[model samples]
Target: MIGTSISRWSMTYFAMALAWLLAALVMMVAGIGYPAADLATPNTLVLVHVVCIGWLSLAMCGALFQFVPVLVAKPLFSEKWELPALALLSAGLVLLLAGFLSLGGRLPPALWLLPLGAVMLVGGFGLVVVDLGLTAWLRPAGPARFVLVGLASLCATAAFGAVFAFALAGCAGSAGEVILAEGIPLHAVAGLGGWLTLTAMGVSYRLLAMFMLSPDVDDQQSRWTLAAGAFAVAVTVAGGALAVGFASGLNVVLSISAILGLASAVLYGRDISGMFRLRKRRHLELNMRMATLSFASLAGTGLLGIALVSIDAFTEQIGAFAFLAIFGWLSGLVLAKLYKIVAFLTWLETYGPVMGRAPTPRVQDLVAEGRATKWFVIYYAAVWIGTVTLLIAEPNTFRIAAVAMIVGVVGIAREIVRIRRLADVAGPQRLPIGTVMPHLLYANP
Candidate 1:
């Protein structure tokens, strides 16, 4: 038997995340956010939070709920909490988005929703942290340690985010002002660099090796990457807090943290490259091929970030850097991985029980990679063009690129839907579940 039952809520989370991503793409194509306007504006904030929380965070959580058990060879501590967490997160995100819309001159009284939503989001993620933390504690694998660190960073990120929301609501007075000015950078760094990036790195270490049929990669370079990443996050958070609190030596502290972060990026890249070289699989799949672009984007983003900070050009380039990091690197990786993961999980759920009793198709049979590869190419190419145009201050060109990205996202979304509905073509008898209900709608497949 599989080590644990598939996470009942995983597909729901994936569906919701993809929906949010599509919405964000539409908004981008409409020129409602960055590259067309100021990055710090309310609309931009709405777009950022929508993508970060609704899309990326939800996807990551769902993956953990499924994969953590696999990694540990133990069932989740409790599957019961999964749906409630998802509910809370979804409701909170809607409220938060509404609050952002209000700040952009919608319902002014709805401003209070910001903190309210933040609290609920924190509560939701807190439950996930508890469940995953306990699971990791029981297993205590090396990768699990990185996950634990990532979960800790997520808590900090949420807490800081809530405070930032309060600051936005004018509830924190002078301290809020200081936090708004000095703490935002730390908040971004911790959430993006520490929480998201570290977790992705940790998960990728396991996934890349497994998918590529590589030798176990729990080596010195991987350890150093994890340690350096953790250290960089620690310094950034502690140094940022102290600088904000004491109002002294902020620049120096930030500089050191940035340097450490860059070092970690280099180590991580080198480690992943080593894994690729050691892989027994000579033919790389589309997912792995696209994943390479994400890795390259990470390296490029790191170099740009370090350069911008060194020359004090951060303010000017922060918009472009965030674009490259979030959309180009992180989002690209998520989408690419999903192409394989969703298919694998779907196959497992649908076919695992009947494998020996009946002839069944392979997991790779579920996805038509030849068709899917085009969408990946379009997505990455558009992202590349969009990033370049944005960096060059070419709004019109960026808007055109954003439209291409929207088309690519729509295409990928269609492909995912098609995969989920494969039971129709494979014949209803092949489905483990009796009904023809949407795969993502039910807790059970």
Candidate 2:
């Protein structure tokens, strides 16, 4: 029963991710300079939102909704609320995207809709967090605790994002720009480093153990990683704001916090390595393959940051590293995970009952990696080239990069379609929910 629920959730996430990816493909083909402008002109910010909110956040929410209960060995507190929560989030995302695109450069009337939609999404997240917290009390599992902390980080990230949304909607004071510029980095830090990374790490701890057939490590390692990650993000983001604002002593503080952030990543990488090294599975599946790719990207991004900082290139090109980390490393991991997760879910929900009674396809049977690998490779390669091009060439780089993104979108969309067809099989394997999956699966990742 738990597996079935999780499978459904995973499907929802994959479907939404498809739609998001498609939208991004359209935008990239339409062409807009990078660095992702919003108020100045609709730039990559729109793309970024599509990926972050529409793709990553939506997918994460769905995955968590299903996985949280299992982690705590409890049924969902409000199973009835699940569909409504998913609907609200999906609707909100559509409204937000509509509002942003319609607004173009200047704030549009539809812009206010983003916050309203966001509010609904946040409410849903809050409910899940509350339920998960309650479950933790009953279960006493280490993953539950980690998930709770990750939820806390998500709340903080959402709060910061809400501030920006309110400011954008003209509900706040003239400090909107200040709020965006200052609060946004914090939001990113919390979302990426704090919420997403922490949760992924925690989940990986359990999932890796299960799949890799490895013994569990001490929870203290994860706990410390979580603590250090959260603290470093908070400090670095805050200090960065001060530095941007030209406050005295901010540079020193920011530098210290940045160092801490780097340290946290190092610890995370070390822990992940331990898991991989101990993995019993000799031949990793597609999901594991993607995960390996993401890890490599993460390490590469870290190295790039070091190079940029050492040469003091950040002042000249702020996004040079951000582009790679967000689109390349973080989003890459998210996409790779989505691939395996979707297939796993499909196999379970559609085929679990028929297990042993019928010839069931392994999760790998759903999608051909041979066909999909090219796209993944193209996507990441283009991203790499785009990053370097943007750093060296500036405005013109987006054009070529945008084209690369389009190619990626097409490739990913094809893979998603292939996965969707698996549910179309007749007999007991039919998905109870229906055949159509959400079409919003795009983003550079």
Top-TM-score structure, candidate number: 1
Among the numbered candidates, top lDDT falls to 1
Residue-level lDDT tens digits of model 2 in 1-445: 3343442344656677667766765665565424544323445556767777777776676667666776777766765565566676677666666556655754555777757866866776666567556656677566666677677778877777676767777776756567665566567777877777777777767766766667675678766776677677667566665665664444566567667777878888888888878878878766677677777778877888788889988656666677777677767776777666666665665566557665655666677887788778877787778778767855456666768766875777667666756633455434433333323332111
TM-score of every candidate relative to the true structure:
0.94, 0.83
Model 2 quality (TM-score): 0.83
lDDT, candidate 1, equals 0.83
Q: What's the distance in Å from true for residue 129, model 2?
A: 3.2
lDDT of each: 0.83, 0.67
Lowest-scoring 10 consecutive residues by lDDT in candidate 1? Answer: 429-438
Error of 2 at 381 (Å): 1.8
Residue-by-residue lDDT tens digits, candidate 1, 1-445:
2435878888888888998998888888788878677888889988888889988999899889988887778899999999999999999998888888888896676789889889899989999999999998887666776788888889888978898888888887898878777887788778888889988988888888889998766666677888888887888888889888998857787778777878888988888888899999989998899999999889889878778778988889788888899988999999999878887777677777666766666777778888889998999999988888977899888888888988888888788777777732455445544333336544454
What's model 1's lDDT at 96? Answer: 86
